[model samples]
Target chain A: MDNLVFERTKGLTKKEFSYCPGCTHGIIHRLVAEVLEELNVLDTAVGVASVGCSVINYEYFDCDMQQAAHGRAPAVATGIKRVNPENTVFTYQGDGDLAAIGTAEIIHAAHRNENISVMFVNNAIFGMTGGQMAPTTLPGQKTTTSQNGRDPYVVGMPIRMSEVLGQIPGAYYVERVSVHNPKHIIKAKKAIKKAFQNQIDGKGFSLVEFISTCPINWRMTPNDSLKWVEDSMIPYYPLGVVKDGDKND
Target chain B: MAKVLMKGNEAMALAAIKGGVDAFFGYPITPQNEIPEYLSRELPKLGKVFVQAESEVAAINMVYGAGGAGARVLTSSSSPGIALKQEGITYMAGSQIPGVIINVMRGGPGLGGIQPSQADYYQVTRGGGNGDYNCIVLAPENVQEAFDLVKESFDLADYYRNPVMIAADGLIGQMMAPVDIDKETPKLDLPEKDWATTGMKNRRTKENKDVDPNIIVSLSLVDTVLEEMNLVLQKKYTHMRENQQRYELINIEDAEIVIVAYGTSSRICRSAMEILKEEGIKVGMIRPITLWPFPEKAFAEIPESVKGLLTVEMSMGQMIDDVKISNNGKLPVGFYGRCGGVIPEPEEIVNAVKDFLGGLNG
Candidate 1:
C-alpha cells in the first residue's frame, strides 16, 4: 500500500517553516502545491499573496508569486489575468486579508467575473499578528483583543464570503473546505484543484475557503483545536459550495 | 492626420488605450475622472481590461499586477487620490514593474480643492511613497502635450522599469485642444509572451507543466536580501537618470534671469516671461519636461552672470525646493503661487519676478 504518507508538496521549497505547531496553513499550502503539480499547471500558475498571515506566501510557493497589500490580491489577480489571460492565476488570502481589508476587491473581482481562482485560508483569527479577532471568528471565540470572547452586540455575525460571493454570475465555483484531519485534508486538495481547473477551463471567479486551525493562539492542544473547529466554527461558517456543482450543501 | 478639439484629460485616456494599454484601474478624482470613464467604455470594445478599484491604493496595485505581467496598464487620479496610491506605487517601483499613473494636479494638504493646482510638484517628482524609489515624472504644458505624453509615459515606464507619472494641472486636464491621433508611431509590442499572464502562452521561458506554483509578490522576510535588491534598484535608477532627462530652453543667451516652472504653472510662467521680455526685462524660460529626472542640465545652460531665478507654480512653493537643491545654493531662488484652487495670475508671477530681481540686482 502506497503510504498515505503526508509530505510537503513539490512546488513548496524545502525552507524551514515558521508556522506554529499544528498550524493548518502549512497543510493547506501543501495541498495547493500538490494540486498545481497534479494539474500540470505549476509552471503556468501565478499566485498573488494577500496581506495578513498569507502575505509571505511568496516564500511558500515556487511558481511566480507576487505579494499585494492587505486585501488587494483579488485586484492584482484581475490585473495579471486580464493582461495574459493565458496563465493560471490565483490569490492566497486569509480572513483578515479577504474579509476585512479586501472585501471590496474580492467582491468586485467576482462581480467582474474575472477568469481567476482564489484560495481563502480562514483560521477565524489573524495568526501572524498574534491572533487578533478575524472577520470569520466565531461569535463567542476569544482572542488577544477579544479577551472576553467576541461580543455579538458589537461585532455582528461573521461573514460568509463564499456564499455571498457565489451569488454573482462570475463566481463559477465557490466552496468551503477544512483540513482538521486527513479525510478533510484530501477533500480540500480536490476542491482547490477543481477551482484551478475551472479557471484553466475558462470558467471564472473560482474560490475555495479552507476552514483552518491556528493551534498556538487558540490556546489549545492540536486535537482541541480540531475539536473547536468542529464544535464551534461549523455552526457559523457551514461548509460547501454556495452556488456551484450538483451538491450545494 | 486630422486634428480635433479634445479635453486634456480625455485625450490622455484615449492615447493610453490607443497606445496598447488594455487594463485600467482607477478611482474617480477631480480633473481625471474622464480617464477611467473613457477606459470603461473603450476597454470593453478592444477586449481590454477596466476595473474601478475600491480605493486609489487598490487601483494602483491592480496596475502593478497587469504591468508585471508585461501589459501596458494605466491609472489616473488627482492629488488626493494619488496620495492613496503612493503605497502601491512604492511596491511597483520596488518590484521594477512598468506602469503609468496620471496625476491631474489639484490644490491640497488635505481635501484641498478640485481646481487645478501644481502643489504636488515635489510629491510627483520626488519619492511619493516610502522607500528609496522614484517615478519618472512628465509635465505637459497643454492639452495636446497631455495626450502625447501619455503614450511617451507608457514607453518610458517600460524602458526604466518604473512607474511614470504624467503630472498635469487641473487646467491642462480640463482644457480643450486640437490633436492628431493618427500620427504614425512605432508598434508597441513589448509583451514578454514567455512571462506575461496573457492567455497566449507561446512565449514563456519555462514550460507550464509539472513545475511548482510560483508567486509574484513584494514581501520579504529576509531583510539583508531586501537591502541587496534595493541596491540593484538604485543602480537602475541612476542609469534611468542619465538616459531619461528631457527639457526645453527659450532665449537663455545674455538673459540675466531664468524662470523655472513645469506643468500648468509653467504655461502661466511662459506668459510672464513674454511680458517681461516685451518690457525690455531680459528673462528666459526653462521648462522641465520630465520632472523626476528633472532637466538639471537646463540650469547648467544658465551662465554665472544670471543674477537670480524665479520659480512659479500653482502650488505655494513645492518645485522651488527642487530648484534650490539643483542649484546647490549657487543662485537666489524666489517662488510664488496660489493654493486651495486659487490660480496665480500671470501678473502676480511677474510681480514676484520683479521683487526677486530688485533683491538680487540691488
Candidate 2:
C-alpha cells in the first residue's frame, strides 16, 4: 500500500491566497500554518492580521483571527494575550505596518514583555500600496514614493529593527531570518517555530523578522526577487538571531 | 447594597467590578485618572486583568482584543485621550466587538483644559471616528448615575454586540456622590458570543468535523459585501434609536420655556429652573440620558404654553444643531453656552430664558 506522504496543514483554510504570483507571503503563511498544526495549537491559536498586503489573512488562517487597523496589530495582540492568557496569540505584520505607523505599539509591547509572537515580514518596500517607500527600504533602493533612489542624505538609512528590538529588556527573543532559498527557508522555519515555542512555554515577546520578497513591488520577476533578497537584502539585514533568551543556539 | 459616598471615578471602578468586567485597559488622563488608579488597586484584588497602556491609542486597541475575545473589557480617558482612541473605537464598531468606553470629557479644540465641559457633544454624538457608525452614548448627569450607567454600558454593549460609551464630564468624574456598589444593575439577555475568539477547543464535533473558525474583522474588500455589512450596521443603529431613547422631564405641563440639557449642564439647568420658578416664570427641563438617540420625542411632549426651547451646554453651541432638528421648527430653539472650560452659571441661564421669554411675548 502506498502511504500518503504529505498533505496540507489543517491550520490553513481551503481558500487560495490572493498574493501576487511570486510573493513569499504564501510560503511564509504555509510555514506558519504548518508550525501551528505541528505544535497541536491550531484550534487554540489566534492570529492578529495587520493592515497591509495581508489584511485579509483572516480568511486564510484556520484559527480564530482578528483584523486590526494599520500598524496597531501589536497592541491588539497584547489585548488578546492578556485576556486569553492560555491561548496562543500571534501577529502577522509587514514593514510598512510595523516600521512606519506602528513603531510605538511594537516598541511598547516589547517593553511590556507582552507574551505574544510576531511574524515581521520585511520586503524592504511597501507591497500593497503600490511600492511606496518603507522605513526598511534600503538607502539606494527605488520606490514609487522614493523615485530618486532613496536619498540617504535626506531620508536616512534603513532602520535595523531586529537590533533595536533586541535591546528592549521585555523582548525575550528576537531574530532576523531570510527565505530567499531552500536552505534559508528551513532556517527561517526553525526561527519561526522557536518564537512560537517561546510563547507556548510562557516566555514573553518573541519576534522573528523574515526578510521576504516583493517581486511585483520590486519590479523584478519571481526568480529575480529571490536573488535580490539574497544578494542585497541579506547583506544589509544579516540573517541570524539577534537575541535569544533561552540561549539554546 | 449599602450606600457610600464615593467620587465618580472610584464609583465607576467599583461598578466595573460589580458589573462583571473581565479586564480593563486604560491610560492616565486628568479628570478620569482615578479610574485607572482605582482599577489598578481593585482589579488585581478581584483577580481581574488590568493594564495601564502606554498610550490611549494602545489602550483602546487592547480593548479591541479583549472584547473580540469575548471578554467584557473597558477603558477610560479624557477629551484629548479619547480623541487618540477614535481609531480603535472605530475598529471595535466595525468588527461588532462589545466593549465599554468612558469618556469623562474635558474642554478641547486642542488639549483645551481638564475642567468640566460638554464640548465633546459633536465628537461623541456624531461619531468621532471616521466611519458611518453610532455608539450607544449614555450621558450621566451625576456621580451616582455615572456608576450606574457605566455598569449598564457593559451589558448593553454585549447585548447589542457593539461599543457603548459613557459620556460624562470632568465634574461628574471628579465630584463625590453617594453610590451603592452592590446595587443590582440588571443584566441583559445576550446571545452567546460564539464569534468570540476564545479558543475553539470544544468546537470539534463528535465525528471529528471542524467548524469554520470565527474571525473578528471589519475589512470587506468586495464592494457588495462591504455595502451589505454597512447596511447591517445601519439596521443595528436604527434599532438602538427606536428602543434606547431616554430622558427625564419635569413640570412640562405648564412651563413657558423648556430647557434641554444633559450631563453637568443639565444640573445647571435644573438650578436655573428653580430660580425661574421662584420668579413666577413657569420653566421646566428635559435631560436626555442617551445623547445619540437624542430625545427628539421630548419635543412632542412640550406644552403649547412653552414659547421657546433653550439648549444649555458647556460648549459654543454644539448640541444646538441636534436641538433644532429634534424640535423640527415647532419651536424656536435658542442656545446659551460658555466656551472653553467655563461652566455656565444658573443666573446666566435663568436670565437667558427670561430674555427669550420676553422677546417671545413682546
Per-model DockQ against the true two-chain complex: 0.54, 0.86
| lDDT string, candidate 1, B51-125, tens digits | 887778778888988887878889999999988889889888887888999999888889988898888887887
User: Model 2, A170-222: lDDT tens per residue?
Assistant: 89999999877889889989988999999999988999999999988888999
Q: What is the TM-score of each candidate against the true structure?
A: 0.91, 0.98
**Which predicted model would earn the best TM-score?**
2
Interface RMSD after interface superposition, each candidate: 3.3, 0.7
Best by lDDT: 2
Q: How much lDDT does candidate 2 score?
A: 0.90
**Fnat: each model in turn:** 0.70, 0.79
CAPRI tier for the interface of model 2: high
Worst 10 residues of 2 chain B by lDDT: B202-211
Single-chain TM-score of chain A, each candidate = 0.93, 0.98
Candidate 2 C-alpha RMSD relative to the actual structure:
1.3
